[model samples]
Target: MKGATMKTTMEKLGIIASYSRPRVSNDNPFSEALFRTCKYRPDWPTKGFATKDDAQAWVKSFTGWYNEEHLHSAIRFVTPAARHAGHDRATLANRASLYANARSQNPERWSGKTRNWQPAGAVWLNPETEISAPEIRDAA
Candidate 1:
């Protein structure tokens, strides 16, 4: 594997590879999480690979989807690109404003900024876990 060759070359050049103690798995938690996500994705090949090219292609596609369309519930139910591009903030704020009005109005009608807001009846029960009501106070 390329890993062995690289390690060997670095060792030959007196480049010491420093790593955390083996017992401390949390030292590379992010790396561990990425590998876990990649391996457990729904589209991953069930029977493993027949060729290096195939595996590489799958990895490329997976990385693109992961960085593009995948909704990370942990990050306000948006993809990384949307968050990085600033759309996520706007989206969250708009939704929160609508919901805040819905909440403040005591269920008479969807009378917030989204005038077209229908009850969607029980659909918002779970609601957005990430969004918070804006700091602005309700109108008197």
Candidate 2:
């Protein structure tokens, strides 16, 4: 009601989004979880920008990475792309098959012992999920 009177003075305006008649905070738990994730992400750049363009660019980058590369363990560690494409399950199956085939093809390629291969020697790839590699390839 007060918003109608001060419409001219408003710095920003948005629709009065309303939820179904549930006073429980659980009704909006998803949004709360999102804010929690945003605040907790170590890489979330929080410093204000001098110009709007800078703010827009940062938002753009964050959106791209969030939607493309971020993996949610709740969603089976698959990127949003895989989930959107409805191929998350298929993609996972393919990856598993590839691993099995690779191991079967050349057991010597991967030593019997597990190798520490995160930053250097070897790497895993995911093609279906935007979090995945652009292309699946042998571990470097």
Candidate 3:
């Protein structure tokens, strides 16, 4: 396998390789955001895990916190678990009502409209180009 390149191996296996454009940040935003969130966590070990078991334990704990407790900004500050369990609607509605009440009490405090608490419509990891949709629709 020393001289076997990825392209050659893929060709032999009948797998087509479709690569992203160089330096395109949108290509893997979800994964990139997750890594950033994990690395920037306050409890991330600076000294590194002493053993594989320690690392695994830490990862398990982190996963629990991330999915169950952390309020994701992109998803309107609701926990992933709540979103998965179909609870985000009520949570976001409660927040929106609270904000509206506060705004009504002190109109001067807010200069503009309250934060948009609308649920995120569609999330894409590697979204298609804007032109692709129209082209596909026209073709169809």
Candidate 4:
């Protein structure tokens, strides 16, 4: 009864529970992915961090690597930092050029056009299908 009441209250407030459906994997994909990355890291201690300071240090390091070094495939294999700083355009362009060169040098080895290698103009976690014209124009 208490759970049902709380759910009703939340609904009235326009709040949705993440695990509303049973046996459904509808959680935020980005957060789940980041957690998986952290859990699978080779440096992650099996037993957990020894102290608060240790946890903080590891988190700092992981955040640095995740933002600056990790090549996120969602963003065309560019690091978050590079994409945020508007440097991904040049990086993607360079990659595209390299792929073109490689394909030209070994024509027989390739069967299709080089990878798109185009920097995504905008990355959305959960985008709406009917995006506004203004948002599209701004992204361009």
Candidate 5:
């Protein structure tokens, strides 16, 4: 922000970050998703922040909660911190066991297999399809 106009906006809002590179509107999906999460948070202020400090403090708290506590559905409901610390594998195994036990206790209640507690293999903003051996052979 080179002008006073943008500075006023910043003061009212807080530290504004550009997720994309300089002079580019092409933000990656991951950054876009994170921004969505921040905007959709239950405690996100509807009105502008009283001061930039207030906004920064709120963002810090949100980041902590997101990393340390929030269970991500894409990652088998484990916190990013837990996954980063290599604790998610154990956590997922425990959940799988618990689900299996519950299913055994009331097998008829379950219409299908219990939800997969397996750790996510990989994450891609835009996943590409790989050709299977059978498909390649048939094509050839």
Candidate 6:
């Protein structure tokens, strides 16, 4: 089918073509987050990438830092690499203990409770909402 004919057929079938937002927002929250972090990195080039190899090398370095060095707030301030390696639990526990000890020695320094170091259970771009099943009607 040609462009116009296909569009008309899609319209009849209640199908709509997505035009805008090509690569800007791909609906992956995780990717969007990583992209935001990558853009904000201090080493992000002010000018565009010079060459394909330069871009690839930059991406590789950024990936290394993002996964191994950067502490992610969503995952209880643990690096993705640490979390993947099953080290986040111990890291968070150590943080909780440190915070507690600090607060005990300097109670006046803290106005509120210490930050929660508990592991973030699950990550979701859009959490699911409750849905009810459609009612069935008898047909004669």
lDDT tens per residue, model 2, 38-74: 7676766678577989778877876787778888665
What residue pairs clash in candidate 5, if any at all? none
Model 4 regions more than 4 Å off: 1-23, 129-140
lDDT of 1 at 107: 62
Q: Which ten residues in a row have the lowest lDDT in candidate 3?
A: 129-138
lDDT measured at residue 99 in model 3 versus the true structure, 0 to 100: 98
Candidate closer to the true structure by TM-score (higher is better), 1 or 3: 3
Model 6 residue 31 CA deviation (Å) reads 3.8
Where is model 3 more than 4 Å wrong at Cα?
A: 1-27, 129-140
Candidate 1, superposed: residue stretches over 4 Å from native: 1-18, 105-140
What are the C-alpha RMSDs, in order, of all predicted structures? 15.4, 15.7, 6.2, 6.9, 12.3, 7.7
lDDT, each prediction: 0.65, 0.58, 0.79, 0.81, 0.81, 0.78
Output the TM-score of candidate 6. 0.69
Quality of model 6 by C-alpha lDDT: 0.78
True-vs-predicted CA distance for residue 21, candidate 6, Å: 5.4
- Deviation from native of the Cα of residue 38 in model 6, angstroms: 1.7
Q: What TM-score, to 2 decimals, does candidate 5 have?
A: 0.67
- Listed in order, each prediction's TM-score against the native is 0.56, 0.46, 0.72, 0.75, 0.67, 0.69
Ranking by lDDT: 4, 5, 3, 6, 1, 2
Off by over 4 Å in 6: 1-30, 129-140
TM-score, cand. 1:
0.56
